[model samples]
Target: MKELSLYLMSLLYITAGVNHFVMPKVYLRIMPPYVPFHKTMVFLSGIAEVLLGVGLLFTLTREWAAWGIILLLIVIFPANVEQLKNKKARGKLPLWVVILRLPLQLVLIWWAWLYT
Candidate 1:
């Protein structure tokens, strides 16, 4: 069960990371206004997610990758918050979905911690 979950988590991050690139404008929209270099941050975060997701596949890097994921989730949290606060960022996404994302971030962080 643990191994299966690990794989799923890796895939989720990998897909999400790829989405950042495939849909750069989507990510750019949610970036907190205060954060500088919006485009650079979006790409760098995508790279980090892909690297960390791959890292989780190996025993030697799993722990570090898990930690990195936790940190990454924390670092990107403001974007989620921005989405909730700024209607334009949320686009046509439902109010409930945007509101739910804040708590979902905590759940994601906790899930990553399990691997650590």
Candidate 2:
């Protein structure tokens, strides 16, 4: 189950990385206006995600990958917060669902830590 979770996470990161490159424009739009060099950040983030995915593929680097993902999740949290705030203002996503997702990050981090 641990291996399965790691593989699934790796697959998800790889796919998300590919999407960053393939559909950068879409990603760019979501980036916070305060972020500078949007395209470069997107590209770099994509590369980092790909590398993290690769890191997860080996047991030797499993812990590193877990830490990396946790850090990444933390780094992106502000964006999620902003999105949730905006959604609330606009009455977009159901408040319950958005609030629910906030705790899910912790679960994902815990899951990553478990296999490390």
Candidate 3:
């Protein structure tokens, strides 16, 4: 179960990272208007996610990778909040899923902390 969770988490990050480069326009569109340098932010975030994802796959840097992921999660949280707010306004992304993700972040952080 633990291994499965780790694999899924790693895969999720890698997929998201790839998307940041391959489909950056989508990500850019979602960025809150107040943020500056949207394109640059997307590119940098992509690189970070890819590195973190690759690191998580190897035992040598798993702890550091987990820590990185936790930090990344914290850093991107405001965007998540903004996404949820937008979705709420649009009546998209069902309320239950949005609510569920709020606590899931904590769980993911705890999981990362444990790995570290």
Q: Candidate order by lDDT, highest to lowest?
A: 1, 3, 2
Candidates in order have lDDT scores of 0.95, 0.77, 0.81
In lDDT terms, how accurate is model 3? 0.81
Which candidate tops lDDT?
A: 1
> lDDT tens digits, residues 1-116, model 1?
99999999999999889988999999999999899999999999999999999899999999999999999999999999999999999999999999989999999999999989
lDDT of 3 by residue, 1-116 (tens): 88888888888888899999998876676577688998999898988998898889899999999999999989877666666677633244676776677778898898878778
Q: After superposition, how far is residue 4 of candidate 1 from its true place, in Å?
A: 0.6
| Model 2: per-residue Cα lDDT over 6-49, one tens digit each | 78999988898888999887566556668789899889888888
State in Å the error of residue 88, model 1. 0.4
Where is model 1 poorest over a 10-residue stretch in terms of lDDT?
A: 11-20
Each candidate structure's count of clashing pairs: 0, 0, 0
Instruction: Score candidate 2 by TM-score against the native.
Output: 0.80
True lDDT of residue 77, candidate 2: 65
